[model samples]
Target: MSRNWTERDIPSQRGRVAVITGANTGLGFDTAKALAERGATVVLAVRDAEKGKKAAAKLGANADVTVQELDLAALDSVRAAAADLRGTLPKIDLLINNAGVMYPPRQTTREGFELQFGTNHLGHFAFTGLLLDLLLPVEGSRVVTVASIAHRIRAAIHFDDLQWENSYDRVAAYGQAKLANLMFSYELQRRLAPRGTTAAVAAHPGVARTELMRNSPAVVRAVFPAVAPLFTQSSERGALPILRAATDPAALGGQYYGPDGLGGYRGRPQVVASSPQSYDVAVQRRLWTVSEELTGVKFPVG
Candidate 1:
């Protein structure tokens, strides 16, 4: 329940392994760095190979960090990265589904799925299932998927038109994806329970300074000039809930953590509640089925 996670809280991670997606920058980068500093061998899965390498190099604080190319929006890249990691490491203590795309000009993934839903939710869903085996044998392992307050922006998943092809609304699609993250987290906690108390927690960065906001219209970015200081928090601070969910003994399944401030905007991390619709079971199952099909991956790990 404690929100704070200093170095002492992580314990010695000598033999453990961690895989973090989109770790080339933003909260993912900070999370990877923090874990690696605690001795967890952290894999930086990123879309750009060059940026990934630079990210690992910048993490001079953590010697165990490595860069691997992973394009979350591209199903092929996701599968290849998982296969490559499986080839190298047999077990992983933490799997942080951290990388995500946000409000971009209406786009589609390499597989043609809506960009936000594809990368932020479906991609991570498949990635975790493919890598589920890597964590089953590790004692007290976990997976943390990043969701957002934007979940409140929309109450439920649009099963009728999940791809937003029928009617594409950028903000709506983003909210749906973030909500999928929470639903997937809870559903995964159920799946991972038999794997020995492995947690499937969800966290949000509370409007941190990340490139996720990039590609937003100029007027959107302009808002950052005045109210920015109040609305935004640093990526390092935003990473606490994720690090805590991954390493904190007190963290449990189905919990939502985010900054504790105005509308859960900017402060320390704490257990929080997401929109009520996030707990819909049928929606969770539907999303999972769609994800497996989209990614051409299977669950039921060894």
Candidate 2:
């Protein structure tokens, strides 16, 4: 993130509209708070209505925030939410695909896609495409995708079995989903760069103390708790790169950012690079093709 930029520097967002998934807590909540505080009319798209409403209320009694029920794992929910948002929001300045599940004891989404991959990758993929119409015409419109360094552990996209039914390993499956997120961000950027309809950028919150890992098994959480204090950063700080990517004039499409120090676990946000696997054009293309087929959503053909 630009060193000089902060909530104090966020310019007026008076009439802007933003939609953030999983805005009930963690990175998503903090991100929503920052934007809403800047005067943006933020829609906290969440799976649970009560939690979303409570979180939005916490932002401020009169904060320009609304709670919308959106379950990413359910395409029907996503479609309905998109339609609702398009009607309510004339334009979308930012779509933060921040909601996701991680490291759960092998489960499946309502659609039967592996829970992690389904929620983290395909969910956002379809959501963005469906919401693109609202986003494309807005000046300075952007779609900020949150990926993770764990993407490096993904062994390719697993073309033959994306659902991972044959060999379902939780961590690898999660990594594959994250990798798909990066590829989608870059590919979307490439496709939209020429016309400048919008930009797609990716950012990772380096090992923040957020609830991203709360779904993990108790044993795993305890093991990591040993060194958690030494490294984990706050969720608000972790949202820096995403806030920067969404609003910073200098942020470019397809660029990825992360923490700048200590193995990228925590520090000021800066432009960062992913592992070589994330740069594979073929894998990215294949992932996009498969995602389109699986989600039954197509990008705008402008």
Candidate 3:
């Protein structure tokens, strides 16, 4: 509800099914571990099945965990993983779009889109759309997208060149993907509100010490070590916002959650706000339409 929200605040997830991408490490692993410990059947949906298995095995001796192969950079992989999940999971109570690429060197996905945008935004878009029907009919079902504070730094939806084909700035491109994440959640919430069963919420880890920063610039990479202890929190703590967005009874559609300290850097989870551009309904709708067109995956809901 306020500061100090932790895994202990998570309700009994007795029969819920959760599918978390990039669950092999960092925030995703912590999220999956917490949900599994709370009695949910958690699927560690990851690009690397071997790492996923390792991560699943560490959850607990008795945790209900499964490893599903999902490569967010590859559209075919997304479809294949979604098809497998469709056959395996009857209903998914939580869908955490937790996996993402941060500041990697310029690269393109197998689909020829920029790697970060393709993996971070469009892949989850297609996966969620493909699997949304399972959640739509279930009460309390939620989709919690993990965005980042970087979304506010320098982010925008580049409708003219969504793939960053003309020019590329890894930082701004990452921002675009993160911004798209929030916009997607907001727009999806608008669509889900009328559906009467599912809700879409967004969250950020607020600069936790995670492997997600491995691709950052050399200076940031060099400086992070010295400042980490002073500035960053652990991945376990970083995961609280996501856990709250997923399980907190009062968390509502379109709500965004993040840390509550030091410009949202390191503290307990709380309901936070995102950038003004992230709330633009027109832009959200446009991105949604373009996403559907690009990914060839359409949501079952309006």
Which pairs of residues have clashing backbones in candidate 3? none
* TM-score, structure 1 vs. true: 0.94
Residue-level lDDT tens digits of model 3 in 266-287: 8888898899999999999999
lDDT of 1 at 18: 88
Which 10 consecutive positions of candidate 3 have the poorest summed lDDT?
1-10
Provide the overall lDDT of each model, using Cα atoms, as 2-decimal numbers: 0.83, 0.87, 0.94
lDDT (Cα, tens digit) per residue for candidate 1, span 1-302: 55565535766777888899999999999998888887889899888989999999998853788888988888788889889999998898889999888888788998888999999998898889878888877778888999999899854688788889987788888999999899889888877776674678899888888888886667888888687788888888888878877877788888888888888778888888888788878878777777777677888732
Off by over 4 Å in 1: 3-8
lDDT of 2 by residue, 1-302 (tens): 36555556566777889899999999999999988888899999999999998998899987999988998888999899888987888789899999999888788888999998999999999999999988888767899999987888754688888899898788888888898899999889888888686889999999888877887667868887898877778898888888888877788898998888778888877889988888988888888888999999999942
Once fitted onto the true fold, the runs of candidate 3 whose alpha carbons sit more than 4 angstroms away are none
The Cα error of candidate 1 at residue 42, in Å, is: 0.8
> TM-score of every model?
0.94, 0.96, 0.98
Give model 1's clash tally. Answer: 0
Question: Among all windows of ten consecutive residues in candidate 2, which has the lowest summed lDDT?
Answer: 1-10
How many backbone collisions does model 3 have? 0
Write the number of the candidate with greater lDDT, choosing between 1 and 2.
2
lDDT of 2 at 244: 81
